[model samples]
Target chain A: MLIFEPHIHMFSRITDDYERLALAGVRGVLEPAFWLGQNRTSVGTFVDYFETLIGWERHRAQQFGIHHFCTMGLNPREANDDRVNKDVLAILPRYCEKDSCVGVGEIGLDDQTKTEEKFMAEQLELAKRHDLPVLVHTPHRDKKKGFERCIAIVKEQNFPMQKLLLDHGNEETIKITRDLGCWSGFSIYPNTKMDPARMVAIVLEYGVERFVINSAADWGVSDPMMVPRTVVKLEQAGVPRSKIEQLVWKNPIGFFAQSGRISEQMLQQPARANLRETFDGNSVLRGQDPDRV
Target chain B: MSRMHEQLATLLGPAAAGADAEFAKVLADRSHLPVVFPGLPRRLGRNHLGGGRTRVGDATIDLDAFRPCDLAAADLLIRCEASDDELFDLYQHGDIEERTMLLRALHVLPVGPITVRMFGEAQRTNMLVHVEAALCDGDLFARTVGQPGFEPDVANRVLLKLAFLDLPLARCLFAERHANPGLSTMLQDLATEREAAGRAVWRDTWRMIGLAPTAGSAARLVGGLEHGDDGVRAAAAEGLLALGRKDLFAFAEERLPREPRADIRAILQRCLA
Candidate 1:
C-alpha cells in the first residue's frame, strides 16, 4: 500500500532514514518551512529557508526514491517576532514561485494573538494573491482559540476554506476544520502529539475524507519513521487496505501534486536502482547488498 | 493632539489619534508605566499556574499570550496586557525575549488618572510597554552586566554566562572570559579534562558490536552463533563478552571455561573484569 506523509519536516531530520521510510512503502513527503531549532533573525532568512525547503531538500529526498515537496510561509512560532515577520512577509512573494513549492502554509497562531492574527491575514492574502493553498498551524496550546482564529482570519480575508490545510489538528480542531471544508492534518508525534493509536481513533471517528497524516518531525524529540509506523498501525487495527491507501496515499497525491512540483508522470518514472547517484552525486549505497530476487 | 495625530484620526478614527503621541512621549521620556488592576499582583502568582485573563480597558487579554514582538516602528503598535512572570515563562521556553519583556513592562506599568482623551491610561501603558520591552534577554543581560556600579562586571558576567548557557550569545561572552588569566586557566583545565574523557557516548554505541568483527557476530550477526564454524564460536564468545551480554555470561563461564588460546582467554577474562 502506498502512503504519503503530507507534513514532515525532513530538513529538521538529519539522516538517510528516508531510505528506510521509502522501503516501508512511503512514496511522498510534504515538508513545510518552520522555525529552525531556534527562531531566525531576519526576513532574508525566510527567503533562504523557502529556497532550501523547495530546493536542496527535494534533491535530497529524490536520492531515496521518495518524492519531496514543500509548503512555505512564516511559521506561527517565528511570527511572534515583528521584525522577522515584516521582512518574511515582504520576501514571501518572490519565493512563492519556486519549483517544488506547493503552497503558503503552516502559518496560523501559536497563542492566538492579535499579532498572529494580523500576520495570518497577511499571509492568507499572499496565498490568495498567488492563487495557492495554505497550511495552517493550529497551536498545540490553546487549540480552540487557534482553530477559531484560523477560521476567522480565513473568513476575514475571504480566502476559500478549501485552499487551507489546517495542521496539528486534534479531534476537536479536526471537526471544526472539516466542518469549515478545509483539509485537516494530524501530526503523528511520539508522546505529546497524536500517536498511531490516536490516529486510528480519529480515522474511525472522522472517516478518511480530507484527512492527512504527517510526521511533523523536527529538532525536538520526534520520530521520522512515525508515518510508516502509523500506516502499519492502521493495518493492524483492521483498517481497509483501500482506506489506508486513500488517507496515506491518494489524498496527499491529490493535495501536493497540485503544486505542479511532483506529478503522477514523475512518480511513474522507473524506480532508479542507483537512486543516490541519480539524485545526488554521492552514493550512500556503496557497500549494501541488493534484494536477492 | 499633534499634527500627525490629527492626520491619523482623520484616516482611521479618534481611536488612532493619540496612539502616536503616547508613543512619542514614551520615546522622549525613558520611563516605565505603572501597574494597573488588570495586572496580576507579583505575589498573586506565587501559587497560580497562570492561565487567567486581565482586561486592558475593555479588551480582555491573557497573560501567557504575551510573546515576542516587533518594536522597530512603535507608532502603529497596540500592546496587549501581560505579566512579567508569565512573560519570563515564555522567554525561558524560547519565546522571543523582546516581546516577553514588553509584556512584562505592560503588566507593571503604573495606572494613572491622566488618560489621553482618545485612549485610556491602560492603552497608553500597553503601547509604551511594547516599545520598551522590545529589548531581548541577551540585550538586557548585556546591559545589566555592563552597567556601572556593578562590581567590575567580571563576576556577574560569569554568572550571567552560566545562566544563559543555552543561548548562543552567552557562549560568545564565555569565550571572552579567556582574556582574564585567572578564569582562563580554570576553564582551560576543565576543557582538557573534558577532551581526555574521549567523549564516547556509552549507551547505544556498542549496539552495532553484533555487526562488527566480533565473536557475537558469528552467532547473532550471521545467525549461526549456536552452530557455526569454530571461528564463529570463538567470535560469538568474544562478542558476547564485549557486549556484556549477561544472558551468555553463565554459558561462557561453564561451556567454554576459558579459551586455550592465550589471546582469546585474556580477552574473555578482561570482559568479565
Candidate 2:
C-alpha cells in the first residue's frame, strides 16, 4: 500500500529511517516545522532549520525514494520566546513561497499561553496571506481547553475550517473536530499520543473522510514507522484495504495537495534513491562505507 | 440521530442497512464507543494488537469500511439531486472537510457565472485547501481563463495569485493558455519587489521570466550573476542558459573566471559550453 505520512520530523530521524520508511511503502512525507526541544535564542537558527526542511531534508528524503514536502511556521512552543518570534514570523512568508514548503503549520497553542495564541493568530494570517492550509499543534496538557481555544481562535480569525488540520487529536477531540468540519490528525507515537489500536478505533467510528494518521516522530522517544504499523493494526482489526489506503495515503494527499505540489501522479512516480547523495560535505553514509553496509 | 449520520446512511443505502442502527448508536453515544466488543477482548498493545483474540462483531466493525463506494455514490447523488443554489449553500456553510468534498465535486456540479464567481471567491481567500479544491485540476482555470476567458483584470489576478502561492505553473489549468504580457509584467514586478526587500525571489518567478523572456529579464539575470549568494548566481546562469539567450553567454563567460564558487563556475561553464 502506498503511504503518505502527513506529519513526521524526518530532520530528527536518522537516514536509515528514510530507507526503512521507503521500504515500508511510504511514498511521501509532510514535515511540518516544529519546535526543537531546546529553546532557540536566535531567529537564524529557525531560518537554518526551515531551509534544511525544504532543501537538505527534501534532498535526503528523495535519496530514499520519498517525496518530501513541509509546512513552514513558528511552532507554538517557540512563539512564547518574545525575542525571536517576531523575526521568525517576518521571514516565514519567504519560506512559505518555496516549492517544497506546502503549508503553515505545526502552529497553534502549546501551553495555551497568551503569547502562543498571539503567534498562532498571526501565523493564521500568514497562512491566509500565503493561501496555505494550517496544521495546528494542540496542547498535550489541558487538551480539551486547548482544542477549544484553537477552534475559537480559528473562528475569530475567520480562517476557513476546511484549511485547518486540528492535529494530535484523541478520543475526546476526534468527534468534535469532525463535527467542526476540520481535518482530524492523530499522532501514533510509542507513548503519550494515541497508539495504533486507538487510531484504528477512531477511523472505524469517523469513517476516514478527513482523518489522517501520522508519526509526529521527533527527538523525543518516537517511532517514524508508526504510520505503517498503524496500517497493519487497522487491517488486522478488519478495516478494509481501501479505507486503510485512504487514511494513510489519499487523505494526506488531499490535504497537502492544496499547495498544488502533491498529486496522485507525483506520488506514483518512483523517486531515485542514491545512497551516495550528500548535503554540503555530509553524506547519509558518513563514517560508513556503502559497500560494507 | 445527527444530520451527518442521516446523510451518510442515506448515501450508503442498502449496503448500510445491516449496521445502520448500530452505526447510529455509535454516533449517538460519542462516549463509550467500543473499540472492540466486550466479549471479544482483543489485547490491544501500543501500535499493534497482541494475544487475546475473539470474533469481530458487526457492531464493532469499522463503519468506514463502507466509505469508498458510499462516497462515490454520494457524489453522484448530489450531482443529480442537488440544485446549484443547494450546492452553493452547502459549500458556503460546510465545514472545511465538507467544503473540500464539495469543491472536488465541482466537475459533476454545474459551472456557470455563479459557480465561476464562487470559485473566484475561494481563490481570493488564499486558503490552500479551498484554492486547491478550486484549482488543482486546472478545470476552474480552464473555464475561467482558458474558455471564453475572464476579464483581463480577473485573469491577471488569478495568474498573480498562482505565482504568489508558489503553485507549480505546470499544475495550473490554463498557465500556457493564459500566458500574456500582462502576466509577465506582474511576475517581473514581484521579482523587483523581492530584490528591493532583500528577500529570496521564488524560483518559479525566475521560470516565469524564462517563459516570457525580455531584455529587462535578461539584464536582471546578468545582474544576478554578480549577486553575493552562490545559489542566486547559479540559478541566474541556469535560467539564462535555459532561455537560450546567447547574448548573455558572453556575459557568463566573462564572469566564469571571477566566480569564486566552483558550483557557480560549473553552471557558468555549462552556459558557455
Candidate 3:
C-alpha cells in the first residue's frame, strides 16, 4: 500500500518523521510552502526557506527513501503580510520551475481578508502562468464560509477547477465541492477538526473520487502520520483497499501531474540517496561519516 | 440533444429515468460545463456499461471503463454550447476520469488543428489510464496520424507504448489500417530493443510486421512461426497471413503439428484453409 503524503510540511519536522513515514509506506510527500510559525520579516527568509524545501529538506527525505516534492507559493497568511508578499510572489515563478516544485499553493484565504484575497489571486495568476496545480489552504475560522469564499474566488477568476485542490475541508465542504470539478482535500489531524475515524465515515459515505488527505504537519501541533493512520482506519472500516489507495496515492498524483512534471512512472522508484551529499556546504548528518551514518 | 445522445439515453433505459432531473437541470445551461462535468459519474452512477461499441470523435471506441450513465452525461458535455477553446480548457483542467470522458467524446467537438493538438497533448501523460483513454479500444489515432498540427508523431509513439505495455495491439481499431513503413520499422526496432534488454516482446508485433513486411522484419515473421512462445508464434502467423504470400503458407503448414497452443494452431490452420 504505497502512499503519497500529498500535503505535509517536513521543513519544520525532525528527521525521524521522514524515517517513520518511510516505514509506514509513504513513498513520496508534497510539502506546500506555508507559514513557518513566526512570520518572517523579510523576503530573504522566504527565499532561503523555499530553497531549503527543494534543497536540503528534499535531500533529507530522500535519505530515508521517501520522495519529497514541494509547492512554491506565498501562503495566505503571508499574503496579508505586505512586507514580503509582493517580493515572495516575484520570486515564486522562478522557484516554480525547480525540478521538485509541483504546484503553486498553500495559498488561499487565511484571515478571510481582502488583502489575503489580493495576494491569493496574484499567486493564482502565477500558477496560471506556470500552468501548475494549486493547493488552496482554506481558513479554519468561520470554516464553512472560508470554503465558500475560496470557491467563489476560484470561480470568479474562472480558474480551471481541475487544477484546484481546496484543502482543510470537512463533511460540509464535501457537499460544496463534490459537484465542482476541483479536487477536494481533507487534512487529517490527530484530534479536533478531522481524525481517522471521521475520515472513514466520509469515505464510506462520499466515496473516494477526486479526494486527497494530508497531515499538513508543520511547526505547530499536528501529526505527520495522519495519512498513514487514516489508511489503517479506512481498512478497519472495510473501505476497499483500492479506494483507500486512490485517496492517498492516485488522487494527489493525478492532481499534481497537471503541472506537466511528476507522474506515476516517475515516482515508481524512490529517488537515489547518497548520505554524503551536501547542500551549500551543509549536510543533515552533522559531521557524521557518510558511510557510517 | 443529438441523435447519439438520444441513443445513449435509450440504452440506459431505467437508469436514465432516475437521472433525468439532474441531467435536465445541468443540461439546461452549458455554462456549467466545467463544474457539472466532474459530478457526472456520481450523479449518473458508474455501473460498468456493458454492450457494443460507441463512437466518439471520428472513431469508434469500446466503453472499456466508461459507464453508460457517464457517456450519456459526457455526450451532454459534448453538446455544451461552449466553443472549442472552452472545451480545450476543460480538457486541460480535467481529472483522469473527466479527461477520459472528454477524449472519448472528441468526435462531437469541433475538429481542426486544436482538436488534433488536444489528442496529441493527452498522449504525453505517463498514467496508463490516460494513455489507455487516448489510444486503446479506439481508432482515434487513425484520424490524426499525419495531420498538419500534430507533431513529433505521437500516434506511432503511442503504438510503441501499446506494445511496451503489452496491451493487445489488436485492440487498436485501425493499427493495420494505418500501418505505414515508419510504424513497422519503429515496431521492429522496439522488438530488437526488448529482445536485447532480455524483456518479453509484444507478441502482436508480428501482426504489424506481417502487414508491412520488410525483408528483415518479414524474415523475423517467418522465424516467428518456429518461436517457442505460443502467443508470439500465433501473432507471427497472423502477421504472415496479411502478406498474402504463398511461400509463407507452406512454412506454416509444415509447422502446424508442432504448434501445441490452440490459438497458434488456429492461425496455422488459417494458412492452409
Residue B193, candidate 1: Cα error in Å is: 46
Instruction: Name the weakest run of 10 consecutive residues (lDDT summed) in model 1 chain B.
Output: B35-44
In model 1 chain A, the worst 10-residue window by lDDT is: A273-282
lDDT of 3 by residue, A159-194 (tens): 899999999999989989999989999988877678
**Interface Cα RMSD per model, in Å?**
23.4, 19.7, 14.3
State TM-scores per candidate: 0.49, 0.52, 0.57
Candidate 1 stretches greater than 4 Å from native:
A260-262, A270-293, B1-273
Instruction: Please give the clash total of every predicted structure, in order.
Output: 12, 2, 2
Report, to 2 decimal places, the DockQ of model 2. 0.01
Model 1, range B1-273, lDDT digits (tens) per residue? 143323323332332334444445444542221211111121112122234444333223333433212111111223322234433332222111223333333322322211111112112222222222321222222222333333333433343222122122222222222223333333333333544885312111112243233332323422323422444445545556655656556555554453455554555565566
lDDT of 1 by residue, A50-138 (tens): 75665456656766777777777888888889779888876666456544567888899887878888989999988887667888888
Report the C-alpha lDDT of model 2 over B32-74, residue by residue, as the tens digit.
1221111011111111122221112111112222232323323
Q: What is candidate 2's CA lDDT for residue B75?
A: 34
DockQ, all candidates in order = 0.01, 0.01, 0.01
lDDT order of candidates, best first?
Answer: 3, 2, 1
